[model samples]
Target: MGQPVMVKPTFEKLIPTIGSSFRCFDRTGLNLPSRWHRHPEIELTYVDRGTGTRLVGDNIDSYRDHDLVLIGSDLPHTWQSDQYLGRKYDRHSAIVIQFHPDFLGEQFFELPEFEAISMMLTSARRGLWFPAEVGEQIGAVMTRMTIEPPVLRLIHLLEVLSELSSCPSAEPLSSQGFAPSLTSASETRTEKVCHYISQHFRNPNLSHEELASHACMNPSAFSRFFKQSTGKTLTEYLNELRIGLACRLLMDSDMSILDVSLEAGFANVSYFNRRFRESRGMTPREYRRRYTEATETSNT
Candidate 1:
């Protein structure tokens, strides 16, 4: 095979023009894809409306209106909006702010006055989700930022960060152990490998040899590279993907355990059961029941 075609993750280059410290996009009403992309800039996003799955690093969860999040530089992420999944009327909308770590100046955030905000940005490497109330408050300021002059908008961005630093409810999204090695030297190769896995992890017959060939590396070398790049063995990575899919199916579908196992690419239901228990600390049925109870309780 003449180098199997690779679908690499999109690298967004959002360089600002002359005299601009950062970029703000007020996407008032828009529908976008679940396109997995990354940039070197830290990002703050506020969802004004819509609901869907938000994926940051290896973390995947649902998001609704007034959702707000901060993503660190080079973290692969995407908001798979309801509209992107064919819920056409559920138009997604958000305000996105992007800036380099040293956008103001190389040592600006290192100053004593910026200590709290600086620490918050460091924690954001794993991504952070703010409560809806915080989202609403920050969203208003971000909305105004769209119309404000460049100088004033820069100041507003600092205010936003200052407020976020003190938010006690800010939750880290991605697992602390989940690290993506997307350095410039290996980014394209890593992105190709990751994107391919994302697209093909559902194949029960998916083999290491196949993946190695796709990445044009020998099996042993590929195994080491994969571990170093993603911090997981190939099997471990695939199981995480499969289990995540199974969880979603359990929550959103009425599929039987056997069917869920088969659909999620496990060769047998017995193995699936064992792996599910290992990963979740409970049987899939128990997980589903707990999730159902929680959902119903919230609804009530």
Candidate 2:
């Protein structure tokens, strides 16, 4: 074989007007994909209604009635709804604004006046929730931006970012893995495999054969497709999945190392310890000890 082909990450981009540096979209009623994707624009989104899973990076959780979130450049995320197929909720709506950091100029953010805004963008890499108290104010500004002229909208955008940066309490969402890496579109064979792995990650015996069968592909074909699409071997992806859950357990529960390893899909403690160390740079016990100490320090 003449060298295996290498695939790069998929990037979705925003299209701005010929002279404009930003784009805005407001949807009164819509259904967004649960598929994970990333683009290189800083995004600010306000969800007026809808409920279901909200994924940012590797953080998996539920979102409800109304949410105002800011996602940094290229941080993967999605708002998977609970709606029936092809159905749209009357009250389900959203406003999204996407822009590049250098929209004004390459050095705009380096100016003294733009320091706070730059910092806010940096913090948003971990994702952000514009604390409820200040959300309405920011949402109102975001709305005004959609109808304003490009010049005025830029001003409104600055006003919104400034307010968010100075809020008495700025809250960060998502975990340390802020880069968008995992993804699958709904009903695709890749999606089927993702669903399968998610449900069966607690079993250490997961193999390429079983995954291929579940996705209706032969082993060789599945391996080729998976690597080409995701740019990672199946085993590497599964190991990351297990380690992610293992981190949660280490932080939130009192489970022993062996138990946590088993629950996260390691067949035995030795393998778990080795993989955990490879991923986290620390053994399970040390990881747990550091996390607990940090929690205790914060509480006290």
Candidate 1: pairs in clash: none
Residue-level lDDT tens digits of model 2 in 1-300: 122122233357679865568987686644533445567799988876565445565555445455778898877666655442244454576789898878888899889998988888988898887665576667777877778888898888888888888875776776664333334332245555654565566678888898887767899988887765444678876887677767767765788888888877889999989988988899989999998888799899
Residues 1-300, candidate 1, lDDT per residue (tens digit)?
Answer: 233355544688988756677889866443433456789899999998876567787776667779999999888787755432224534456899999998778999999999999999999999999999999999999989988899999999999999999999999988888777767646677667765766566789989999898888999999998877666788987887787778777876789999988887899999999999999999999999999999999999
Predictions in order: lDDT:
0.81, 0.71
TM-score of 2: 0.59
Q: List candidate 2 stretches off by more than 4 Å.
A: 1-10, 84-91, 177-300
Return the lDDT, model 2, position 293: 89
TM-score each candidate. Answer: 0.77, 0.59
